[model samples]
Target: MNMLIFKRFSLTILILGTLVACKETNKNPQKKISETITSETQNDFLGNYVAKEYHQRTEGYDWISVAVRNKGDNTIGISVRSRADKKRPTCTFDSKAFKVNDSLYRACSNGVGILFSFKKDSLKILTEIPEQADALQFYCSGGGNFTGDYGRIEGELDSSQIDPTLFTKTLELQGIGFSVSSFARNNKKILQILPYGLEIDNSAITRTLEGSIADVEIEDLNSDGFPEILVYLSSDGSGSYGDVIGYSVNNGKSISAIYFPPISENDELKKGYMGHDEFSIIETTLAQRFPIYREGDTNANPTGGIRQIEYQLVDGEASRKFVIKNSTDFPEKN
Candidate 1:
């Protein structure tokens, strides 16, 4: 009887121990799977993102690129670059407990500051600092515009002084056909402009530029509440011909190409035909406008010649009566 009781007690203890061991074993796998899922979610957010912020007072647009990566310590590493300035600025923070709320994450260096927040899959940037009372209140929001590929940006220029019904247009040069190729305004419109012709079409919002657009600074020449388009056309891949074109948005929701001089001339200047290469517009004064073009030889050698054409707009039409040609050694001084 004593041996039977001892055996029964041993069996009961053994069963209880086995049950406890099995429970712990099952929990280990569950914990591992939960960790894996979390890791994957973090990686999905680790990539390049494009965001835009609008300045109302100055009527300027700020495009920003952000790179996020997991630091393996329950935190995320962030690197930021300005599309306007083209420099990298970096910051670090604990992302494990971070949440996008009414308040934003602020950072600054070298006279530059950025305030950002992440909401769902998109990021928002605050354009105004808290101290600036007269500053415009702008927020950058993204997502739902593309089919889960590239991001899209929409800029709302706060010109309370201007007509509220007036629309702002953003033009991006796509390529150079016999004329200039362009993808304008959130890739909604594609335009081709030649010496005396124009072609316009719609583009896929998710598509990217098939050809390289010459890197040039776009400026508002006429200050007519619109930004101009500057395109660089390359002759032989060596150098480029400068083509400067002005554009404005009409009430019909269509882009109207404002023909500036040199871009509209039927004849080339004394140096050569306007190559339609890369060019930019200079607004020296409210009354004066000049188109600066980069011209090179067929061998891509700098012919040492740059052309500056003066332009005027009267009654909503462009006039290009002044032509000034100069070499590198004798550029016309402003």
Candidate 2:
């Protein structure tokens, strides 16, 4: 009877141990399922997307490609490339994680902290620093066509309305300084006309003029049917006293004259005169044909002086009326 009791106790202990082991086995599977779901859901955003609206404001292109890839070990990586210029891929975002289309995305642990979300087809960029929001907008939209000229921006156009090939050609033409105007067609020549000097060049569009020019007056001065430009040259330390140089656009391009009052002229009327200095040009009305030159010393505390020179173009020649110098401001001729 004691032996039977011992056998029964042993059986009871075996049954309890089996039940506990079964419970533990069931819990392990549940934990595993949870981990699998997290991994699958978190990586749903790994893929490539194209920027739809971002192509409009940037370097004259229609689309930019954005890519998100999983970097193993719970991290993500992001990159961007332009459809127009593929050679220049801007930057990379590492360790980035965000939601896209109701899916979670994550980047590598050691990458840039850039995150992005999707609203339909557009990307909503997020960064660890709030100020980076503005920067991301710029990055996405800054792919417009660069004319490769003097930083002139070429606007992106609707693909349906304009041909991309033709648009690019137009931009290239403008870069070379060719344009259509009412005055001239296929105007391939460019000239630099300044008050102190004139530079005539077929490649004027490629060069940028550096110097202070004030008060530009464009007129049919010689009545040769072409516009003549008048400007004032003021003297800094680099050059001499201010003088007026006139250029005639007629007959291609030519310097008509450099105006400097005779030295024997009255001292009061020449108070602001620098033998050969620089000047600024102020634009008044078309009827006023006089050029006003601002004169002053090159040193600190330079004295203020104003000189007014009246000019008329008759038969392709510049005729000077009179010059008046004043310490005070010169009144605009009515």
Q: Considering every candidate listed, which one attains the maximal lDDT?
A: 2
Candidate 1 global TM-score: 0.30
lDDT (Cα) of model 2: 0.34
- For all predicted structures, in order, the TM-scores are 0.30, 0.26
lDDT by residue for model 1 (1-334), tens: 2333423433344334323323422322211212212213444455555543422224444344445554322234444333332222121111111212232233321112333444345554432233321121111122111101123233322223222111122223222112233444563434443321123432212222333343322334444543344443333243334443344333213344554444444344434433434232334211111223345444433333334344443224353222333322223222
Q: How many backbone clashes does candidate 2 have?
A: 29
Q: lDDT for each of the candidates?
A: 0.33, 0.34
The CA lDDT at 94 in model 1 is: 15
What range of 10 consecutive residues in model 2 has the weakest lDDT sum? 166-175
Q: Which candidate number maximizes TM-score? A: 1
lDDT of 2 by residue, 258-303 (tens): 3445433655545544444322222221121112335544533233
User: Could you tell me the lDDT of residue 317 within candidate 1?
Assistant: 35
